[model samples]
Target: MRQMAVIAPVAMVMVGGLSGCDAAQPTDSRFAPDYQGVETTLLDGDLVKFDVAMQGARGPVDVENYAECAAAQYALIRGYGFARHLRTNVYEEAGLWRGDAVYTISPALPRGVRTIDAEVVTASCVENGIPMV
Candidate 1:
């Protein structure tokens, strides 16, 4: 009975700790991204760039995924069915991690990071359970 009492408190503490984790996920594949906080820029031609704020407990991969989702959605909105991944800058500052991704949109998939099909890209986002712009 004494051992059970000690285990009960320990289990409660573990559950409480897990509940405090701040990781969040999209409700569905078609869910729009929380791009309200993301910054975007349009360079010369079809070059588009974005910087997304990494949420708590998110790492570089997560940031990359977020950027990719936004880029894909942006291209689709621009009437471009494809995009080429230019580059992504991942950095940390002030205890926050950020990802700056660049891509070029076109009617046909450009060279780089493989061909990006708008439909497949969006589907990939959905499969990955990431939000689109």
Candidate 2:
């Protein structure tokens, strides 16, 4: 009976502690203005959507241009190599030559990591004969 009383309190405490933890806290992947390599162009910028797995927890994001969008994705993957968390394969569709770039990011991210900002190095389209976007 005495042991039961002690065990009850201990179990309650453990449960309480776990409930307080934010194992399921929502993550924000929205990027702020002034992001590197972000710009507006003729195509009006590419669209970025989170993969099915990444939809809720990690959130979704959109980019206006393909060059910056693709580079940002590349930088994000390369950046994650430093942290060594779970990874998602990102690939590009045919868009650059047409003055746009489309990419797919997937597999959701674990808790803790929220937004990833990647610098855009190449501007594939421009008014004066193909400047970077």
Candidate 3:
């Protein structure tokens, strides 16, 4: 009976600990992002350059994502179904973030690991409230 009593308390404590582990972490609700715009330049056939700017970005990743979303939408507008990521340069100055990215648009899946389906990426961008041009 004494062992049973001790085991009951221990089991209760373990269950409480496990329940706490599943608790949701707090997120910052002050995250307000402003997407400036995107400027696209055609370097050559199938090769395109995207310049994107934004404000209130959390980090370089946000700027890069803006450029990526632009590339994906551009590919779709050009009647291409796929875009291959080439490179992206991200920088922040004062309170503004900018990304200079290059991508290759193709009718079919391009020859690269960093490839994106235009339709899928554009859908995700729209769902995430990201602007594209």
Candidate 4:
């Protein structure tokens, strides 16, 4: 009885979490304009470049936002709270949108152009429907 009460909630939470998981690679076309994945490269100094691509009928703005989300998540993984956007090149080819974004990570907001709070950016990404990796 007591064991069932404890296990029931745990099981329910686990099932809910799994069924509601939104991070998986989506195969259905219903989620069009979907985020595919991200490629990251550590550059000289504290800069990291993220190349993000997506499939479907998305636009350049979507791809750029997805890349920025990747950068924000990466900054958080690296124990940083801010990312300074250096540059980004967005393009579309063969029905795919790809963006190459460069960012510098720092604990404090970088005194440069387009500095982003990683936590804020990540939250905004979730709200804007941009997938992060």
Pairs of colliding residues, candidate 1: none
What's the candidate order when arranged by decreasing lDDT?
Answer: 3, 4, 1, 2
Highest-TM-score candidate:
3
Give candidate 4's TM-score: 0.72
Error (Å) of candidate 4 at residue 71 is: 0.6
- TM-score order, best first, reads 3, 4, 1, 2
Runs of candidate 2 with Cα error greater than 4 angstroms are 30-133
Question: Higher lDDT: candidate 1 or 4?
Answer: 4
Shift in Å, residue 99, candidate 2: 23
Q: Poorest 10 consecutive residues of model 1 by lDDT?
A: 28-37
Per-prediction TM-score to the true structure, in the order listed:
0.65, 0.24, 0.79, 0.72
**What's the distance in Å from true for residue 79, model 1?**
0.5
Cα lDDT tens digits, model 4, 11-127, are 999999998977867675565576778999999767999998888744667777888899899999999999998899998888878889989998998897799999999999899
The stretch of ten residues in a row with the least summed lDDT in candidate 3 is: 22-31
- Winner by lDDT: 3
Residue-level lDDT for 52 in candidate 1: 83
Candidate 4: 10-residue stretch with minimal lDDT: 26-35
lDDT of 3 by residue, 22-50 (tens): 66878876867999999999999999999
